[model samples]
Target chain A: MDLAPPIRFELRRGAVTAIPLAIAVGLFGVSFGVLSASTGGMGALPAIVMSATTFAGSAQFAAASVLAGGGGPVTAILAALLLNARYLPIGVSVARFMLGGRVARFVQSQLVVDESWAIASRGGGEFDPHRLVGAGVVLWCAWVAGTVIGVLGGEALGDPAALGLDAAFPALFLALLVPQLGGRRARAAAALGAGIAVVLVPFTPAGVPIIAAAGAAVIGLVRR
Target chain B: MSESWAIVLAVGAGTMAIKAAGPVLLGSRPLPAQVQRVVALLAPALLAALVATAALASGQQLVIDARLLGLAAAAVALALRAPVLLVGAIAAAAAAVARLAGLG
Candidate 1:
């Protein structure tokens, strides 16, 4: 079905606003592509296919790293799923805004990523679904395109970490976090979450630290 | 299918299910007031955790490496109110320079 003019305008504006972040994410996609193709036991086709289908960066990287370390399929899949556990809460947060039939809602849900979600957020628990969908589309395209380039380039891409693309994830996350640090409760949660993650990093599995940190948000339950 | 294909398809399927679970299950239900408050704080908490893990840890170990330089540079850029893209670029450049200087 066709989008209404107002929604279409919002979508376009979202796409435009997301372009810069998309470029950064695309470069990170290139790193994933190279890693999967080179040592993750996934060839060019499967790597690209995974990127297109899964559309989750940290989870994909975790799975590929597991495989690269000679872990089995079950291990890789589990690691990826654990890394993605955050999506459950993320989905809940935005569910009401996701209007449409089941099929459309599912399709829109596919577009939700950390970057797009952050971009779509209006403080105080609000969101713009059109912006989320729009940004997701652009970022998805860039991710897949970057994967194609990386997998095809393969060995020639050398060490992606050397290019500092790995740094982009943290950088991007920091930028996203700063904007949301507006209130005392938010700041407290942020500090608690970061502390939990930092302390757990040395003791937990790949995805555990991040997941454990989400518990810090339970502080929101206390009256300010 | 090859093991790689199997893993890829399985992970894809699993992640799709995970992503869809919320919108599918909740389906426009009105969340409780407390739940809404928690949801509002979720993004900041998650993003902060992401920053900590992505910048400071590699695997199960905390590695104080060049990624820290990148993150610090990003902090400075963000403080100066740089756009997100420039913040990322500044970060990558800082990490790359650190690596070139034999830091990581």
Candidate 2:
């Protein structure tokens, strides 16, 4: 973890936008918490702790589906691995900026996410790994907070939950995704993954098949 | 212990391992620039792919639906280089209206 003194100074100077970012992350977390319940999550404790520790919202959602459906460990692991393979690149990209030793890089790796990637990739400035740790911790907490509410308060959703409120996530993720569209290969791969997932959803578990489709698309890209 | 937690634990462990690979492997050696550029684009590309997967669904053997409509609307907005937020709202609105009209 990044030390308190310097990261605190950075926070005081307003170089970090932890609060807004955490709230934004909180929305996603709430949805996932509701999702955990919808997917038959164990209890608030397990659900919240899962969100806090894993810190990958999509993977957590996907995992919920897998566990709900009585999927095997291999299926869960493979699905999580595929869903999170995107992080491999995030790790590599952030690796470019670290001036610290092995321990620092290791910690920074766990904290890498959409916001951290944005912060790190914006430029090579004075934002240290400490700040990144602080942001990750906040983001993780926001997600956990949302999970707690979602699990405990989930029964309150009633009709909205029944009406497929989970669709909101795919919609939200899609919105976050549209702007970055570029190049033929990338377009092709995206199309392939979506196509396969849509086609395969009925035959397989809800989120699992989609992730499998993503793996297939990634393989195709790797080959190309 | 929820089964979901099991999956999360597995993912957390997997993510940490993937995150540690490059830095630990290189050990103070700067990576090739070409590799860096490629790595930079990987997350965005995968995000786009996952986004597309999230948006569309296949019903009764690839019938057209609101998702396709939303996708097309999103495409037009995108071609005009609309802001990301606007494009998403426009496309989603178009799709939602169509679905609400019982067209999905």
Candidate 3:
């Protein structure tokens, strides 16, 4: 592995690599903010705080949806937590890259998410610690900034669904999933997961199907 | 605090704990080979599941709607190797246009 680049250089590279996805992330954040704000009980401030603190788009959106559907706070939190359980494996993958002391590791762990994890682990077996930190910083800022914009303009934005922003969530995931479909095994695992989730959709709660689908990864353990 | 705020705070704390678990517990030790392989596959598998659930299901019901058009547009854009941002834009536009046409 090459010597770690200077923090500034890594930060710049991370920001640049993340810029395109950040726009989509920003849009998602804006939609989440608008949805949370419009969901009756949640106000703009709570929405902003949730985005700032949680920093997990899908989890937050799931929680908000639960709340909107008349679920209690405990139920909403549980749903969000279940949705976020993916971060455990993600954190394990990025743990080696989280350099420095225990405090630094703890603080940096907060940046673990789908995009940052994907970017940092893009090198396959080797991990880029700088990219991890840099991407986390840029993506975090975009998420929070987008939420602020959404909260302020949420009413004006009026119905993110009508704008097709709701579809953008799956669209973004699809875009990310495309590049990973390179190998036959990966494609099979993905197909199995999707098939299971689709089959369970009508019977499951919002986030449960995804967790259940994680079982499909067990196929990776099987020899061809 | 208000109920919403409390929920946010609780969720936030729970999330931070979940995020912290791997780094704190695993430290520098490598995962077992089989575990690592499965972990590697988790992202693609979970992401595929998320895409299916998000695109095909609304709440608890499965329904095909404008989102399908949007997903198709995204697929076409991705196949053409458009920039990631452009893919999203194309999908959104396709879905919005479809909705306007009462296809949603």
TM-score of chain B of each: 0.94, 0.65, 0.95
Model 1 Cα lDDT, one tens digit per residue, A115-150: 999989988889899999989999999999999998
**Candidate 2: deviation at residue A42, Å?**
3.2
Interface RMSD of each candidate, angstroms, one decimal: 1.0, 5.6, 1.6
Q: Mind giving the per-residue lDDT tens digits that candidate 2 earns over A1-224? A: 36567667744333255555465457667766776676445456667877766677767766665666677656766766766666665565566556578887777677776655543343221234555666676766787888887877776755432232333434444544453345555456556556666666567544444445444334322534
| Order of the predicted models by lDDT, top scorer first | 1, 3, 2
- Worst 10-residue lDDT window, candidate 1 chain A: A34-43
Please provide, for model 2 over B13-93, each residue's C-alpha lDDT reduced to its tens digit, 9 standing for 90 to 100. Answer: 787787677655565555575554445344444555455555554321435566666767766776687654465556657
Over A25-139, each residue of candidate 3 has an lDDT whose tens digit, in order, gives 8988888877777756477899899888899998998888887778888888888998888787778877766787778888889987788776666633346777777788889
Tell me the docking grade of candidate 1.
high
The alpha-carbon deviation from the true structure for residue B11 of candidate 3, after best TM-score superposition, in angstroms, is 0.3
Off by over 4 Å in 3: A1-10, A123-126
Candidate 1 whole-model C-alpha lDDT, 0 to 1: 0.90
Residue runs of model 1 more than 4 Å from their true location after superposition: none
Order of models, best DockQ first: 1, 3, 2
- Candidate 3 clash pair list: none
Top candidate, metric TM-score: 1
Indicate whether candidate 1 or candidate 3 has the larger TM-score: 1
